[model samples]
Target: MTTAPFEFFELHVLRATRISPGFARVTLGGAGLGRLASGGRDQRIKLFLPRPGQQEVAVPVGAGTEWWPAWQRMDADERAVMRTYTIREQRRAPDELDIDFALHGDTGPACSWALTARPGDPATVLGPVEEDNGGVDFRPPTDADSVLVCGDATALPAVAGILAALPPGMPARVWIDVEHAADRQELPTKADAEITWLCRDVPPGPGGPRGATVDGQPAGAKHPMLEAMRAAAVPGGAPYAWLAGEAGCVKALRRHLVNDRGVDRRRVTFTGYWRRGTSEDDLIRQAIAAAA
Candidate 1:
């Protein structure tokens, strides 16, 4: 099979609806989307959203090795805002995709855009042009006896997609952290999984952030997800672990699994979907520095 080069496509909001207190699902469809086949559950894509007051995203063509440098050189007013999001669902006949955004009001650009996004809002996406794109991150070995999955509200869509993709009656354990009860939603899955919802002490409201803290954690504390994860028993027999959400929690969970729980680091797949109080540019710089 030949690999397809990642390319950008212009899309528009077919619809936008509030799914839960913390999530809003946006459906996007446009031309040049037929090649986007559903390959895996944790599929990642980049969304180039219009900046404030802009009607459409104006991104440069030929986004390759030089794309970033050129983009950085562009005037700040002309550059579009880019964000990473997971594909919540895909429909082939209509060639449309669903993405769930954690709406935190005016806190972040993506959240702000999603909160006000209406039908026909123009956007751009960078994704694979083939079904078997390698960007899918949740790869569990076939022989693994059980599975462990955990994340905060930001990862709910990916976790649900992954659970639905699991083989029938596979044993799994899932832990999800949210800021309030309203943030919880029905996670339909065929896998035999025990799901624990960790609700933080803070109540979610119009201005509050979801998954900003863990249950019983004091204000301004760290590793609430790690503490919650530690309290639960890992599934038995060569279990594969998939972790996501905040970068600090990802690191803490990885550390616990590898250093304390005796799980092989090789069996764990983790990604820092976002970091608290950091921008996407900061994350890109951090990745570059780590690679260096």
Candidate 2:
């Protein structure tokens, strides 16, 4: 059976706040956002950002699969930038949702647009309608007794969402790496979680690069987060591991869990949220290659 097409909503920024030195929170509301009342953890949506000199935001409409190509066909100057973000919270009664964006320097289109976004700023988001739950990548087995979660700043919002979804008393452990001390935020969870914050001591590379790899190690081997992850002990139980972050580091961690640690391959879930020097599209291409 053919799945239903996703619905699109034109959102206005209700508010914007600097939650942390490296994070910004944008609250968006639209008439159609109430459809997300039952959204799941790590739910993702694509944001359509206005191109340079554009004042109004318009969302393309068609079958789920068709909208993308149709949007791509539009004149380059008329097209809005597309970027993926996780829904931090869904508030139905007020028809508002929260999205937490990781702030790097104003280098990329999405980052630049967000840096100066103000209340009443117009944008478009393609999200799930009432019929579907959209696409959420985090899936830990219910029968598992312990959960292992790890990521860098890019995956922090998703990690927070997953922790909120886990049941009380669930044994969970999290290791998050951040570029600055100000990047850490309180993550509330009912699960018995042992959280570790890994703050980097080295100077960061220029904010974006594609397929960046270190010599004699994995792609993101130069990142300190991977070393911390490598040294940590996996909690003993029927553990389900969910790892996300830089693509190269993710690959290395997955190898550690499945090959070095002997965790069941089927019980591990992983995603490469981004790469050190690549765009989201590049990450998608790498994911496809890995699957092949």
Best by lDDT: 1
User: Candidate 2 residues 11-103, lDDT tens each?
Assistant: 889988888778888889877777654355677788888887888764576546677556656775677877888878777677888888887
Number of clashes in model 2? 3
The TM-scores of all predictions, comma-separated, are 0.85, 0.85
**Per-candidate RMSD, Å:** 4.7, 6.3
lDDT of each: 0.79, 0.74
> Local error of candidate 1 at 159, Å?
0.7
Cα lDDT tens digits, model 1, 34-97, are 8776666788888899989888697776756456666666676778987888888888787998
State candidate 2's TM-score: 0.85
Clashing pairs in 2: 209-277, 209-278, 210-277
Candidate 2: 10-residue stretch with minimal lDDT: 210-219
Give candidate 2 regions above 4 Å deviation.
1-5, 130-134, 201-221, 281-292
